[model samples]
Target chain A: MKALEQKILTDGIVLSDTILKVDTFLNHQMDPLLMKQIGEEFAARFQHKEITKVLTIESSGIAPAIMAALQLEVPMIFARKRKSLTLQDGLLTSNVYSFTKQEETEISVAKKFLTEDDHILIIDDFLANGQAALGLLHIVEQAGATAAGIGIVIEKAFQDGGERLRERGIQVESLARIESLQDGKVQFVKETRRVEV
Target chain B: MKALEQKILTDGIVLSDTILKVDTFLNHQMDPLLMKQIGEEFAARFQHKEITKVLTIESSGIAPAIMAALQLEVPMIFARKRKSLTLQDGLLTSNVYSFTKQEETEISVAKKFLTEDDHILIIDDFLANGQAALGLLHIVEQAGATAAGIGIVIEKAFQDGGERLRERGIQVESLARIESLQDGKVQFVKETRRVEV
Candidate 1:
C-alpha cells in the first residue's frame, strides 16, 4: 500500500479537480512490479474471505485483478464491454453508466463462467462514482453469487460512491484514498481511524 | 503448451464453424494458474528478445500482458478502447475494426509511455483479423518504437491476419494455431515445421 501510495505521488498527475491520471503507472502504462505489491496487499487484506473468483470490468481492471487472482490462487472473470462473436447467447448482462464517457453501456459475463455457489471479490483501478463497481455487483447478484468484498487501487474519497457503498455495509478496501485534489495537490485521509483488515 | 492444448480440448467450446469459445478459462473467466503457465511459456519463447516493454490492447489482452510482463520483468502498456476521464490528452491513437462487433473503434495509448528507444513485444488474447494487433503495431510505429515480436494465445490459421504479419517478416508466436474447426472439432496445425520462437 505504501509503494502504491508512493507511486501515485511520484507518477500520477492530477488533470483536474475531479480526474486523477495515473496512466503513467497504473492503468494505461502499467508497472508490473508495483502491481504485484498492490496485489499482495489486497491478498493480505482479504485473506480471510472465501474468494472463488475475482471479478472486474475490462481495460483497466484486468491487470490488478489478474495479479490478485494469482496471489489469491483463484480464477478471474472480466466483464466485456461489447459483445464479441465468440461469446454465446447466454450471458449475465448489466447496464453501467460511465461517469467519464457519459454513456450507459451494458457489461456482460458469460453465464457458464459464474454460478450461484461462487464467492466473488470485485477489483478495479479507480473508484470515482463507483458505477463500474456497482455494475459488477449487480452481475454478481444476478448470478446469485456472494459478494465477498471489493478491492480498489485508488478511491476518490471526496466522491459519494465510496461512502454510498459503505452505507450499504459492503466491505471495501482501497490502497490509496484521495480525500481531495485541490490546486493540483492530493490530500489523503489521515490515519485517525484504522481500517479493520 | 500441453496444458493449454488440453484446456482447449476440454473446456473450449466450438460454438459454430468459425467460433471457439474458451471463455471458461481464457478470456471471460480466466484461470490464473493457466494464465501464469501461458505467461511463462511466452517468456520462455521470447526470452532471447530484448523486450523493454510489453504492449497490448485493453480488456482481454490485459491479463496475459500483465502475466507476461511479470515473467519478463518489464513494464506493460495497454491501449484503451475508449479514453476515460483519467487518461491524459496527448496519445498515439489508431483505428481498429472488430470483425466480431462489426464496427470500427478508436484505440489510444499515452505518448509518454512508449518511446523510440523501447523494444516492445505485443501480446493479445486472439489474433483473428489482426486488426487489434495491427492497430497496436501502428501505435508502436507512431512512437518510433521497435516491435521485437508478437505473441498470441490463439491464432485462427484460416484467418489472413497471422499470414499477413508473417509476410511482413514480423515474428509471431501463437501458442495454439487452429487450422480448422470442422464439425465441432478443433484441429491444430501439425508440429512438423518448426514455428518461429
Candidate 2:
C-alpha cells in the first residue's frame, strides 16, 4: 500500500478536483512490479476467505485482477462492457453509469463462468462513485455467488461510494484512499482501518 | 508450447469455422497458472530480443501482457479502446476495425509512455484478421518505437492476419496455430518452426 501510495503521489496527475489520471503506472500504462506487490497485498489480506474467483470489469480492472488471481491462484472472470458475438446468450448483466463518460452502459459476465459455489473477490483500478463496483456486485449476486471481498487500487474517499458499501457491511479494501483532492493536491485519509502488512 | 497446444485441444471451444473460443483459459475466464506458463513461453521465445516494454491492447490482451512483463521484468503499456477525460491530449492513436463488432474504433496510448528508444513486443489473445495487431503496430510506428516481436496466444491460420504480418517481416510466435475448425473440430497446424519450450 505504501508503494502504491508513493506511486500515486509521484506519477499520478490530478486532472481536476474529481478526476485523477494514473495512466503512467496504474491503468493505461501498467507497472507489473507494483501490481505484483499489490496483488500480494490483496492475497495476504483475503487469504483467510474462500475466494474462488476474482471478478472485474473490462479495460482497467483486467491487469490488477489478473495479478490478484495469480497471487490467489484462482480463476479471474472479467465482465465485458460490450456484448461480443462470441459470448453466449445466457449472461448475468448489470447496468453501470460511468461518471467519466457520462453514459449508462451494461456490463455482463457469462452465466457459465460464475456459479453459486463460488466466492468472488471484486478488483478494479478506481472506485469513485462506486457504480462499477455496484454493477459487479449485482452480477455476483445474480449468479448466487458470495462476495468474499472487494479490492481496489485507489478509492476517492471524499465520494460516497466507499462509505455506501461500508454502510451495507461489505468488506472493501483500497490500497490508497484519497481524503480530498483540493487545489490540485491529493490528500490521503489521515486514518484508516487496520490492514495486515 | 506443448502445454499451450494441449490446453487448446482440451479446453478451447471451436465455436465455428473461423472462431475458436479460449475464454475458459485465455480470455474472459482466465486461468492464471496457464497464463504463467504462457508468460514463460513468451520469455523463452523472445529472450534473444531486446524488449524494453510489452505492448498490448486492452481487455483480453492485458493478462498475457502482464504475465509476459512479469517474466521479462519490464513495463507494460496497454492501448485503451476509448479516450477518457483523464487522458492527456497528446497520444499515439490508430484506427482498429473489429471483426466481431463490425466497426472501426480508435485506440490510443499516452505519448509519454512510449518512446523511440523502446523496443516493444506486442502481445494479444487472438489474431483473426490481424486488424488489432496492425493497429498496435501502427501505434508503435507512430511512437517511432521498434517492435521486437509479436506473441499471440492463438492465431487463426485460415485468416490473413498472420500471413500479412509475416509478409511484412514481423517476427510472430503463436503458441497454437489452428489450421481449421471444420464441423466444430479444431485442427492445429503442424509445428514447422522451432519454438522455445
Of the true interface contacts, what fraction does each candidate have?
A: 0.93, 0.93
Real interface contacts reproduced by model 1, as a fraction: 0.93
Model 2: which docking level applies? high
TM-score of chain B of each: 0.96, 0.96
Each candidate's DockQ: 0.78, 0.86
lDDT of 1 by residue, A120-180 (tens): 9999988988999999999999999998989999999899878766767778998899998
Clashes of each: 0, 0
Q: Write the per-residue lDDT of candidate 2 for residues B68-135, one digit (tens) a residue.
A: 99899999999988787777499899999998888899999899888999999999989889999999
CAPRI accuracy category, model 1: medium
Model 1 clash pairs are: none
Candidate 2 interface RMSD to the true structure: 0.9
Considering only N, C-alpha and C atoms within 3 Å, which residue pairs clash in candidate 2?
Answer: none
Residue B142 CA displacement from its true place in model 2, Å: 1.2
The candidate maximizing TM-score is 2
Q: Candidate 1, TM-score vs. the true structure? A: 0.95
Query: Residues B90-148, candidate 1, lDDT per residue (tens digit)?
Result: 89999999988888999999898888999899999999999999999999999999988
